[model samples]
Target: MTAPTTPAAEALPHQGPAAGTTPLIIRVHGTPAGQGRVSFFGKGRAVHSNHKKLMPWRAAITDAARRELAYAFPADAARLVDGQPVPILLGAIAAEITVTVPKPKSAPKRLTSWPITRTSHDIDHHARAVLDALTHAQVWKDDAQVVEMTIRKVYPGEGIDALDRPGALIRIWPIPTEAVGR
Candidate 1:
């Protein structure tokens, strides 16, 4: 059987050196539920905040996670006055799946046409809530709305930091609304 072609590889954003480009001190957390801490490399950096970790779900449900991880946090954040450092996220890690990719193989003695698999995509999305949480004090309110906002703002596939397995699939959870009984 034939194979599919990959889209043109996109270059990472070139924002110049981190020296003046507004770097954030991001901390990460992985526990009963993955948690993240954002702070500067140094300077006793920290913010008193709490963000939730989403559960891995099915395809349809993935949408809400994107919205929440990408949009909600930014929306819920407190308004920043000025000069206060904006948060910069590294990424999150939680549950994961592994996808293997094919590669040419080379042996210590010789090379062979036989196909060998190399590299794997570490599945992740729930971790995004942390990245999405970073923003000016005012912007990230620590709420689902902020996550939703972030999802809407970032281009698809780009919102989740580069941490998922290459062939990893994603799951989305639906946004909860009021019950019909009221």
Candidate 2:
């Protein structure tokens, strides 16, 4: 038996979408969530649009993720091809992926950049991991970005902090020091 203080807190989509032929896609909201989208895709764009160079393609992460899921999880052939009805117990079959929008611990006044891409499963998975990383400051890699999330700076603890700090990438640029001084 264990005493409960605060809620256990629901686990975000840690694994692939749900277990089924239908694909699962998850969209996370918050600082890292937004930036992760841009970075992972490796494209710069309008505040809410994805240019061709990017991975997500500007249709909203949910829609983009759904398409990704469709490829990852094609319809069951045994039922559809073999001419058998999907069992009633399973309910209408469609890919089911959940996006988790956790409340922020703190928020930044200004945001600078987000990684262009995660490069794992799809755009959605990377977003969740990137945002989570930004929140926890566990993982950050200064990558040469042709798009978004290409250059990542993950902060550890302290919510609503500098995951989106301005010019964070500019600092990472290869600037030569000790010039014209002595």
Candidate 3:
């Protein structure tokens, strides 16, 4: 199937260093969900894991990534290799993800800038969900392509931050080929 064309795509240069330098930013507006633990079911002879709790969150992230990618890259820019479509950003990637969760009702009003130390979900679990969603969206070849990642979890209105809503802000930069293995 052919890719869709748009005015924005037509206006952008077909080839340039901009793609490499400019980071793709995606703002997912919703309560961020952490990756759940693997839960096994059935008896010893037939045990299987059920890890579906984060599916909704993952789907949201995938949708947001897809929209951001479409806005950043031309639809026709996709290349074919071995009969499969290749993602625009190839090679290693550096990602910075900021997850903002809602302030707990139990938190004191004066404690607006404090960290969330009592939460059950860890920051790494949230990062995993986002990374997996990006992979599903084909933002890159695989999640393994992410060589550098910085993830932070915070409550809304924390530490001079303007994002008062519960969500995640993801920024992905393509690492230049020459910068790898150094």
Candidate 4:
């Protein structure tokens, strides 16, 4: 089957104590997949494999991130090292991610306001997949730079209108150096 089409990523102006900075926002379209357990194989050296669905999800996240980064910082788009695009954000980073899944058709019509408790995967697993992809996309130097993160999973209408279908919304900010210790 063909991969689902995702909307273009956006860089939204942040309005707060930090006025000039804009947060990188990415909307990934399609059913969000969790990072599956790594399976080990081979007798001598030991090999490992990831979940079948994880690669596609990660690719989607990476592509979206790259597109947004280039659009947000056009000057940086030309800066490449070893034929790879350099990461845009550095130092401590903050991320907020919302994964939205489709509302099941079998659900009772009366159960509209309740949280999704019967998801196929845990919230953290979904976070892992996205984070890893962001790292691969060179959105930041490394996932370790993410000092603050808020991630959640919800169904369609429970989240924003952009995510009315199954997908994820990722927002990333670079935390000021002064905010590290305190």
Candidate 5:
């Protein structure tokens, strides 16, 4: 019997980026019960007085994210840059933030999920809270380094086993150095 012949290499489509070229990425899993902090204003228009309580919340979440990153990249986290600890993630970055809230019990019995959150917290507000925390945690050199961002907020839908839980999932990756057009 004749041996089977392989198809020409050119016949196959390029499925993805070349191996070894994938951008460095990190994922920070969040608590199911955490709520994004809200910005508020205090009497006399003092920013510090208005944000005193919120600062602690931001710090706690930032610490959590920092710990996760360090756990995954101890060596990188320990590295020094210009005599200071290096921000493991650097360069232009892209971030995707997905916030999950528990399904609203007040909805009609037949409605398992709402199309969107109608609460006082806007999607941008949630994103800002996280981004600010990330900046504080030094996930990157600065929040300004994030050139692209996508944020979404939704309540648990049907078949989502973790409906009782709520949290945010953050995905961050460095944009290719050459792609920055700097």
Candidate 6:
């Protein structure tokens, strides 16, 4: 069978975001994930095996985020569908991502908080994956729109819901143009 497609905007109402409003916020739910490695082949070709496996998983998250955005701002979604050039946000922008992983049983009792994670998986790699997914989800015109970003990967602290599970919390916002120095 073939994969399904995003419904056409014509079928949906034209409801985008307001001219001046709270910046869009999307929570991708679940442990923040990363991208797969690229394996090189002869003649400079490359392939990503993990990507094929992760496609569906990533698409699910993207689709869910898009749905939420559509529900929240139909006009905005339709504006994008109308082929309006994405007025790439100018000035500085910031993004914050918190990757919460379940604590392991092997942990010592002395630890009372989520410890910083040091892994081979680069934090930017995970952020790239998320940005790519969000771009596909139409969270924005492009990932380059983000100028400043802060990311963290750690086990959820005690009393935190993620302590029992794993998930990602992402925040994207635009900085006032006046706030920019350059």
Candidate with the greatest lDDT versus the true structure? 4
lDDT of 2 at 58: 21
Compared with the true structure, what per-residue lDDT tens digits does model 5 show for residues 1-182? 97665555323433322346443333333432223443456664434322644466467558777787788778887787787767867766777666665556675657555435445255776677678888877777788887778767656544332233455666777766544333
Q: Please report how far candidate 2 places residue 27 from its true position, in Å.
A: 3.9
Residue 57 C-alpha lDDT in model 6: 47
Better of 1 and 5 by lDDT: 5
Q: CA RMSD for every model?
A: 18.1, 20.5, 12.1, 12.1, 8.8, 14.4
Question: Which ranges in model 6 have alpha carbons more than 4 Å from their true place?
Answer: 1-21, 40-46, 80-92, 113-120, 158-164
Off by over 4 Å in 4: 1-17, 43-50, 113-118, 160-162
List, residue by residue over 1-182, the lDDT tens digit for candidate 3: 97897766555422222343877889887767788566455564431122444677788899998888777886633556887757767887888888887777777877655545646267888888899899888888899988778778877767533267878888888777644322
Q: What's the TM for model 6?
A: 0.65
Which digits, one per residue and each the tens of the lDDT, describe model 6 over residues 1-182?
96664545223421222236455555555544467688889898986556664565467568766776777767665554356523334444567666665566766666666544543246666777777887777677778887777777666655333323465666666665443422
Output the lDDT of residue 104, model 5. 61
lDDT per residue, candidate 2, 1-182, as tens digits? Answer: 97654433332222322333233223322322333333333455333223242233223443433343345434631233246322211221222222222223353426532333332124454344433322222111211221122223333221233222311111111111222122
* Predicted candidate 4 versus true structure: per-residue lDDT over 49-81, tens digit per residue: 445667777888888888888888889966999
Q: Can you tell me which runs of candidate 2 are displaced by over 4 Å?
A: 1-23, 28-62, 76-182
Candidate 1 lDDT tens digits, 8-127? 323222221223333222212222122234445467865422333222222213333334444544542332347553332222211222211222234222332221222211122333
What is the TM-score (0 to 1) of candidate 3? 0.74
Give each model's whole-structure lDDT.
0.27, 0.28, 0.73, 0.75, 0.59, 0.60
lDDT ranking from best candidate downward: 4, 3, 6, 5, 2, 1
Off by over 4 Å in 3: 1-20, 41-53, 76-85, 115-120, 160-162, 180-182
TM-score, each model? Answer: 0.21, 0.18, 0.74, 0.79, 0.63, 0.65
Error of 3 at 31 (Å): 1.3
Which residue pairs show collisions in model 4?
none
